[model samples]
Target chain A: MAIFSLWVINKAGGLVYQRNFADGLAQLTSNEHLVLAGTLHGIHAITSRLSPIGASSGAQVIEGESFKMTIFLTATGTKFVLFTSLHETTTDSVLQRVYEAYADAVMKNPFHTPEMPIRSEGFDSRITALIGTGQS
Target chain B: MTIYSLYIFDRHCTCVYYQDWHRTKRPKPAVEGGILPAVSHAITPQPLPADSNAGSTFTSPRNTLTSTSGVVIAVNEPISPGPGLYQTPPSHQQTQANPPPSTSGLAFDEEAKLVYGVILSLRNMIKRISGRDEQFTNYRTSTYKLHLYETLSGYKFVMLSDPNTDSLRFVLRQIYNGPFLDFVVRNPLVIMDSKERGIDNEYFRANTDRLVKGLSVFP
Candidate 1:
């Protein structure tokens, strides 16, 4: 089980935070990450509206043969997105841990601004530590 | 605990078949046929006497849905008195060729086009992220999940069901292999991707309904 990458999108649909691991997958440029993140944001909103049921949530999982992307949307509209291997059994636990870390390291940080690119060193180390332990 | 609908898109990206069991507000008819949209309004006043046991207000509109859908449901009524497997006369099947009539009022051609667009963009995204060997199976919303099964022949079978249910891709595959192959693909009488017609027939609809009803999660 391995996590390939992580993306944090602000409520405004901007790519605020992005990171990559698992070197085997093809890498993307910063521009590509912004484009992909924006596209995903748009698609997520469209999917939520596509359903005939009440529109509380949108797409949660997009699975491929080798990897799967799990998206968690917070009540405030911020999205925590993760791309992991298909065999990753601890995704939910890992995501819960990451959310807890975000609440601590990012949200509580005085230097961190809302809806902007995340650049705090403490949050970076915390995410790295989370991903390190997340690998099984 | 409900299966909403199923749509089959042929190679040309045209919705060739559609069926829905529990859907509430009907989809507005596409602007393609100004007359058909008018017909939908005219038919809305009368309600179909359907079993309300599902605790859904959706079943009330089943009878006056559309001519093609109305016939398909009526053919399956207990009044027909046919065995589990029996022949339905060719006349009982919807055979309109020109104008490519939409079957059910629950979802129209316009909605099907949006369905195709969703999957198409999702599939394209999957391709961009992973190799060609990988494909997307399903995506979920708060209320429902959409399962997709793509055939080598370019047929796409999409089913929407309760979000709590497990993967329904296997069920979609079975439909493609069973009823779809038997009634549509294998039969020479039906054109595969004709723009002027849909591939829906009584045999396929009955078998699909039976298959969905047989599912453990169906409610």
Candidate 2:
């Protein structure tokens, strides 16, 4: 199984960070990438509003030809988007570990700015290490 | 989950049209002023030598005709050898003569040029390496996807959409065959030879917007 990429979106639908582990994907302009995050956030909000009573409003999986997207939302309104190959089945645990790492390495960092695009080296290294072990 | 914009470039690497729908931080148009010339210069196909044309069929209009995935493509015929669309600007040389300015303000246009350059380079590289003149359809990233449909005449239709958006090659072809060919290409008033300009007709814009909105999955 292959993991393609990852994205982090804030509550305002802005993309805070993005990383690609695989190649051959179409590259987007920085503005276009930001627009994509906003669009997804709007779609998620609309989906939540349309949800039936007693059901969760957040989107979970978006399946494609060769890959699948899994969205994990945090209590503080942060979103983690994981793009994994179709055969990858154990993603929940992976997402949970990533969330834990983000809380420890990003949120707790004194230099990290709130609601801005994440630029912390610690967060990157931690997430990279987590992804390495998860893939193995 | 949404479409941000659409850009159409001609065979000359001129961005003939650009439209934004859902983008927030719109970059200044002047920022893109250097991209067209840079890209045109980068991807100008090498001219064939005089001896290689032996026995080649001399077709009227000089355009090469081919079909891919049910879409008809017409390769653009070389118009002239002089300074028409193929000429690269001297500004590129001026930068060599004098020191270039800092790149902080040119980030957006730089990325745009890079994207176009990469696409053109990859297309030519793949054709040469694989020995197949296959047409590019679409490519996806983790968050978004880009769809491309090119006419034989070298007019390219490109759309940026959500990664999970179903294949829209047929839709792009339809737009090309239906509204684009009818309203823009064939219209006498619409000048196709202009540089750094888009098709500026209300009829084309209205109809195209309608066509795009009519799609079942567009949101």
Candidate 3:
């Protein structure tokens, strides 16, 4: 399965980063990325707040079937979202790999600002390597 | 005169320079406490000479120092033993001891500032798109975040992600801090309010970092 894109939303549901890897998905305007981030954040907050203590921690929060989105938290309390096509149940693993890549490339780089677009050379290279590895 | 000294004992390099503009000598303003000893001691920022424009191909401000002193101390800094809490205080102290020179105004020209501003804004944009938090190593954090994205079309759009409200603020502070702060803000070459649009990602990618270094200013 090919992963298509990624989006990150702050705890407050603001859109932080959005990128698409493939060309099939319909393009969205820059404003739309912001709106989409806010919308997803809103949805995530509602889901978390509504869930009972037991249900919130373990279950995969699903927004729709068209695309699958998974969120993971880091040791330092940051949320990462990985958006993939509608074919997977084991997205947590892929998302984890992306997180590792982010930690190494984006977070570690002095120039990288948290919750922003991916611009580090290391990031692009690592992502390309990971995606390429997955393809083969 | 430019004076260079090499400390054989400490293996440090020291340089100092001073120039007299011979303009009206205004009295230095007294500042409270130890906030800004250097600025408090300096003369007023005079307008550039009538013959020299800001962006002209001349010596940069760093090159034209009125009075400057620099000593590169070659201290044998100890490597940290581990990722422990014990090392945090000293690391912070080190940062305080040697503040990073501003990397923004290297070119020191009108267009250079504009270019540098664009680079700073782009870097900020990349940071935003990467979903990283912004830390102003200078002081406390600013309350708002400016989000920008450049599409493949070579256009750039910025959004204000205010923490206190829902309304979006579409101002580019980096650009404001850049050369076009006065020109771009007042001139009609740009649009401030747009819902969201496609932009030239390549154009930004090509020029941003170059601009960042060009507009950097050193103390």
Candidate topping lDDT: 1
- Native-structure RMSD, model 3: 21.7
**Candidate 1 falls in which docking quality class?**
incorrect
Worst ten-residue run, lDDT, model 2 chain B?
Answer: B61-70
DockQ of each: 0.18, 0.02, 0.02
For residues A1-136, what per-residue lDDT tens digits would candidate 1 score against the true structure? 7898899987767799989877645577888778778777767755654565444367888766678789998877788988998778777777887888888989999998888898988888998898966675
Error of 1 at B97 (Å): 38
Worst 10 residues of 3 chain B by lDDT: B2-11
Put down candidate 3 lDDT per residue, B1-219, tens digits, no spaces. 111100000001100101111112222221122111111113212233322322222222222111111222332244332222123244443443333332122221221222223324334432343344431111000222223333233223333222222212112234324423343334454332222211112333233323433432201
- What 10-residue stretch in candidate 1 chain A is worst by lDDT? A47-56
Better of 1 and 2 by DockQ: 1
Candidate lDDT scores, in order, read 0.68, 0.57, 0.36
Using DockQ as the measure, which candidate wins? Answer: 1
C-alpha lDDT (0 to 100) for residue A86 of candidate 2: 63
